[model samples]
Target: MKRTNEKIAEQFKTFQILDEEGKVVNEEAMPKLSDDELKELMTRMVYTRILDQRSIALNRQGRLGFYAPTAGQEASQLGSQFALEKEDFILPGYRDVPQLIWHGLPLYKAFLFSRGHYIGNQFPDGVNALSPQIIIGAQYVQTAGVAMGMQKRGQKSVAITYTGDGGTSQGDFYEGMNFAGAFNSPAIFIVQNNRFAISTPVEKQTAADTLAQKAVAAGIEGVQVDGMDVLAVYTVTKEARERAVNGEGPTLIEMLTYRYGPHTMAGDDPTRYRSEELDNEWEKKDPLVRFRKFLEEKGIWSEDEENAVIERAKDEIKAAIKEADNTPKQKVTDLIGNMYETLPANLNEQMEEYKAKESK
Candidate 1:
């Protein structure tokens, strides 16, 4: 058993491009992206960091509802999303709003979703994503189904989903990968293993040496990557997407990342379960910090450019919050009505009854 675990671990060595000091350790693994493209990736990460900060503040002030902070996982989230075409489907977990927004979900709608407003679930034309799934690992099965649909339609698009280390323990995670592999579904399952699932550290989540190795049971390809290295994340995702679209079946990517904040704005306290020293250690590997150094070394990024993006993000976030605030209060009737295309007779009556009461 020990030897078997060791072999799996050896096979799934963590792929990394940039090291902690923002130096490229694996030159061969560096992604081929234009300077502008690199800057855009940095911009997205910075903007998302600002967004996470503002969201935490908003949640505190009672202006927003449930929020999962995305501070340290920017590279893992945006880097992968950057590899996706707009047509690809994204089924994100509650912590993955950044990916949804980048994939074309309106920022205002994301804010609305956090506020529990019905409009938040309403995607505009051309946006191909489901709202962030709050139930852990639920999106896994859904991604498999969506990918199978894409395969049947002979579309080149892939279905992608994100969950955390804790989510890997869920049955849906395995079922999704198994179904996708069985049908050669064009799916990408990403596990952002950020060391902890709420108060439970990942070590306590499972006995497996690594989450990526779990893909072997489903007969799918799996690999772990340095989630702090944006370029590495993007490179791996791009390859996985290519493999998916080319009928090579699904790939399960485990991003070795971290969340610098609590699990959620709903009262998770990381300090209660983790150490300040550990937090400080992950901070050294902050995605934005290292990616910034890499770009700066190439003369493709500067503090001025980053500051501008930060200011723009702040402005946009302010406007989005205002728009969310201006939205009509979510009604029970709206929820019931949107729950189905054709409401059942019982639900139809309830919808009507609620509509009447709401009107009053």
Candidate 2:
């Protein structure tokens, strides 16, 4: 049965399977994932936590350039990616490292990118296509274009674009939705409504009641989900993808979440605006802690098992960081070499001038 507006709103507000005490609350909606799958999710969450922490530490130590930590948003990232098909294209924002990792991007690639490696954007052999977008809302239109291309080719695959709440305010957001609606393109716009866009709160971004509701203006369905609840996010995203594949047009999803940490290592201090009390409150509702409690209630989690998973992930992430740091840096000529098949006259002239200067 199609969910009614009341049910949808309720699900959006709260679809938690676990309580703060690590207890299962929503038995029916509790994912039927096997013990192995649950363990894998937990392990991935741990790995993401470690990677985020390490990356932040590296930035502080001058070993990395800028870093965006996804520490508190692992469930939102992992669960959404898990709901996607292998052939589906993902347009990810800078803070979505966990989503890329879930899509099979190696940890080394993320480390390389964090350290300013250009080759990190190049997808590895046989890897799913995912190049991180640095511009706030640019990926929205790009993903819509990709989905339009897929529609033209009669492909059933969909494109899922991830962005922050602040991105929704950009003109590209509306343009993408309009285009998708006009052509019934296979696309899903996922707004990870993390409450704050850098230091600006969501209240300043818009007053549309909710971000998802904006889809109505574009003539598409809009849905909101409790992003902290992995199961909830997966359920809604999977349904949205199915709708797109079935030619029902695109769906806009606003995932209500919070960024517990600073926007990025290079950004303004979050403490200047956000209260530390609110941060502590969010920590109490940490997705990992909630999910673990739910799993424990089902007799599927153990302390020993969790410890082993953490230990293994720590080793893997440490190795990946080392490999990324050790990888050879790109040569100076790589900038010109990676360009189009035929260089423009202006570019050629600049390159020649640069070479002449170097020779002198």
Candidate 3:
């Protein structure tokens, strides 16, 4: 007899191994890593936080054109990103800079992207990540196509895509999920449910009780995880990657987390949509803070180590900014040229105009 007792489709439960106070609620369920590995996770979280802060400051200074802040969702993004293979393709949304960086996108290239420079579109030779998709749920469809290609070639490489709670609402989200499911494609879909999709909160976005359940219609497995717990996220994502590479299928993960700042650097006031008290309450469960405490307990982290890591992060970010500054500016003609092998008449005319102007 087929059982229907609390399946993922029937009811999605938030998976968590760690508590807010850095204590393991389920020791067996927690991912076991060496001291060095644990320390790496802590370091990456700190680095991501610093990077997010730096980008926010740069945006405010009019140095960046458009950037999304990924402050409180470090564990959600980084932990999953760490689980992927080097050859895996990453289809990222705008708020997923840390993941993009982890997937071989240089820090400077990401900065250039925020600055609206064309150089950001170019990835390192071996890196398989794409530039962040500005359209909300567009990456979903893109990832599906990529996964389909990987499957046809019988390559172990998979395509992992990320979206927000808002992305789940788009038609592309369903279409992508459905296509992957039908083909049993090698793809992983991650939903970083950071409570708010811009000014609109998740509660208002859908009537569904859990975002993970959305995968049911697509005939794929989905689960909800504590986005604040790096270990839990790493475990789930690593297992998901293995399954995809092994030809099991795609999975949808909904990470329950919060965004501590405004949705974007476009001057949207988070305060107008949410309360200070709510933000303060969520701060108690900050991913970096909790992970740092865990590492300290393992005797792998200390005040000195933490300080050094912070300084290193700052230096790395400084170097990225310098690299971006030193790079040549984006050209109008290049933009028009890169779009297609055969350009339309209007774009050709525009490119010619720019070329003539540049020749002056």
Top of the candidates by lDDT: 1
Clashes of 3: 0
- The alpha-carbon deviation from the true structure for residue 281 of candidate 3, after best TM-score superposition, in angstroms, is 1.3
- Candidate 1 or 3, higher lDDT? 1
What's the lDDT for candidate 1? 0.93
1-360 in candidate 2: lDDT tens per residue?
235544434533544555666665677876567777777777777777877877788789887786787877887788888778888888899998778877878888877777768777777765555678888899889988999998999988899988999999899999989999999999999998888887788888775557887887899988877778777777778889999999999999888787777898886688998998988988887888877877777788889888887788778878887898788876545676568688799878877876776567
Q: Rate residue 142 of model 1 by lDDT.
A: 100
C-alpha local distance difference test of each model: 0.93, 0.80, 0.89
lDDT of 1 at 189: 98
Candidate 3 local distance difference test against the native:
0.89
Tens-digit lDDT track for model 1 on 281-342? Answer: 99999999999998899888998999899999999999999999998888898789788999
Please write out the lDDT profile of model 3 over residues 1-360, one tens digit for every residue: 124423443678789988998888988887767888888888889888988898888888887779888899999999998888899999999998788887788899988988888888889898888889999999999999999999999899899999999999899999999999999999999999988898888989987778998888899989899999999999999988988999999999999999898888787899998998999999999998888887778787999988898899999999989899899888888788889999999998999999999889
Q: lDDT of model 1 at residue 265? A: 85
Off by over 4 Å in 2: 1-25, 349-360
Leading candidate by TM-score: 1
- Residue 73 deviation, candidate 3, in Å? 0.5
After TM-score superposition, what is the CA distance of residue 42 in candidate 3 from its true location, in Å? 0.9
